[model samples]
Target: MEDLFYFKLFLAFTVGSTMVTLATVAAERLGSRIGGLIGGIPSAVAISLFFIGYTETPQLASEATSTIPLTMGLNGLFLVIYVGLARWGAWIAMAGALFFWVALAFLVILLNFNNFLFSLLFFILSLAGSYLILEKGYHLPSTEKILMPYTPLQILSRAFFSGSIISGAVYLSRVGGPIWGGIMAPFPTIYISTLIIMAKSKGVEFSRRITKPLLVSGMVNVVVYSTAVRYFYVLFGLALGTVLALGISAASTYGIYWFLKKRMS
Candidate 1:
């Protein structure tokens, strides 16, 4: 049992840190749109759900995914808040985003929002609303590649934040049943880490430029991943199911990236 617990933490930390480091680096080299898309991929959630199924049951993991879309909707709002408040300062932006995320995420738990379609509707609304506000209202543009040298500290900081958040989510999911697990699985740890790293290194405008793409990519990624997990985990079992779901997510992410790339061009 102790070994399993340690293993879970280790898995979470390794995946979290690796994903953030790669995404941040990609964002710096390729541009925010690409970086955001990469960052938004189904990294931590995949790991979280896999362990959920492994530690508990496949049905439980599938049920836990029901709230993912709704939680992802809240995450969209999370980016909106962060982008809106970013010009003020990192602390304000971080605090405001987190405050809203926690408040509304618990609202999801309190209301017992378990219906999949309704959660889908909530996610659709968030998808549309966040895009319009960020792209139309904010008039945020796609950022060109901003070249910067990588330092060990930057990588470590991003990894630390992402790893810690994901580890907490994984641990919490064990206590909360499927709904709690589902919501907790898709927590915006990557987004939080990305924003902090980018806002500090690249500044507010850069952060703002990335938010729309991040929203588009992140939400879509979660929706597809959760949907896949809901169905796939039971049919295929953990190892195979995780791979299949990840494949689907990768395909969908490519589709989103291609569309966004065309739009940006």
Candidate 2:
């Protein structure tokens, strides 16, 4: 049993890293809007939820899954903060945002509603509110095209950072209860890492432009995916559940992306 656990952990790290690396590369090659859409895919979240379901009881996994959308909604706030303050420079904006994330995470955990229905309600409200707050006065920058080159080392580093975060979240899910696990699941690992790289290479404005679409797409993707995973993981098994959930998430993200592009354009 212990050996199986370790193997699944290893697999999560490997696959999660690959997916994030690919997403990062896609973001660079495609440009900010497309990159944000790809980054919003919830690759790491899917892997974490799958392994959680695989290693723990279905009930626990379902409980954990319920919190994901709420946490992701919080992540949208994090992006809003970071992008809103990007003029302060990447390090300061990120530092301030991280502080807010931690404080808000603790507050949510303390609230501890733990009811799936309430979580879904909170997720919807928070996502909509955050999107409105972010988009209220902000104007999308004119389309700018630039490609930032990454060396092999940088690519590897990005993958490593993302995989490490996913692995840590999995470990936390075991140590912490479902609520804590759910809170940690959407920690913005990929967003922070990718944003830092983009800020350094492409400039802060370029990176900031990516966050609006990322926030919109990510919230839609995770809410749909996590809700599906919560139900399907129990109704079906982990494998089929994950597949069906991911398919739903992909469709939702694509639709949201299309809507956002049209709205912004």
Candidate 3:
């Protein structure tokens, strides 16, 4: 039943993107700048974080993850630091997914998770993501997007936001693992993008939409960190938690992106 719910959530997002794409196409035909911008690429930061949040949310929220809360905290923190320094937004968003996948593969090699179930869950998720990228090309406006290089504000904003989200996700996932840790990673980013678009249409430029999510999201992670440290003695510890966490996040991320890239091409 729970797995079914997840599938439904994925389906909803898939349908939502389709509707948005259709609207974008209509807007393109109407020849309005706002419509055209609607069809444009979301900031790379948005896309990356969206993926992270989607993957991690269930882990952090579920009863299964509760059994290893300490593992989740340590695992999340270890992974966050690794991704925080990455040069690109895509890398950070994809890290947990990539790590999830790699870790899963090795787990199978060592016979940890049930092989059949792992393969089934992975294939379904991968297909959904691939279908999304294939169905809609971001079609960024050359004039506006190309100006990213010259926009001091945009460059700085992207760097700071991307780094903060990845670092926070990493740490929180330590307390939450894939369920909580993975899901928490992307909320602020998603919230920011949704608002930026709505505000752009209305011509509002308040930084609050972006900054507030950052603060709230970071606070949530800080809570997880404090909770983890308090119960640190209880986590019993996984032998190679960090490596495994990285492997887990990295593999899933790579598989989905590769599938999307190939399908779109």
Point out the worst 10-residue segment of candidate 3 by lDDT.
Answer: 140-149
> Candidate 2, residues 144-216: lDDT per residue as tens digits?
3335577778889978987877777777778787887688777888678768888988888888887766676
TM for candidate 2 is: 0.87
Candidate with more favorable, higher TM-score: 2 or 3: 2
Residue 219 in candidate 3 has what lDDT?
A: 25
Any residue pairs clashing in model 2, and if so which? none
Q: Model 1, residue 130: displacement in angstroms? A: 0.7
Top lDDT hit:
1
Least well predicted 10-residue stretch by lDDT in candidate 1: 142-151
Stretches off by above 4 angstroms in model 2 are 26-40, 140-149
Please write out the lDDT profile of model 1 over residues 176-229, one tens digit for every residue. 678887778788876776676677788867877878767887889879998998
| Total backbone collisions, model 2 | 0
lDDT of each: 0.79, 0.78, 0.34
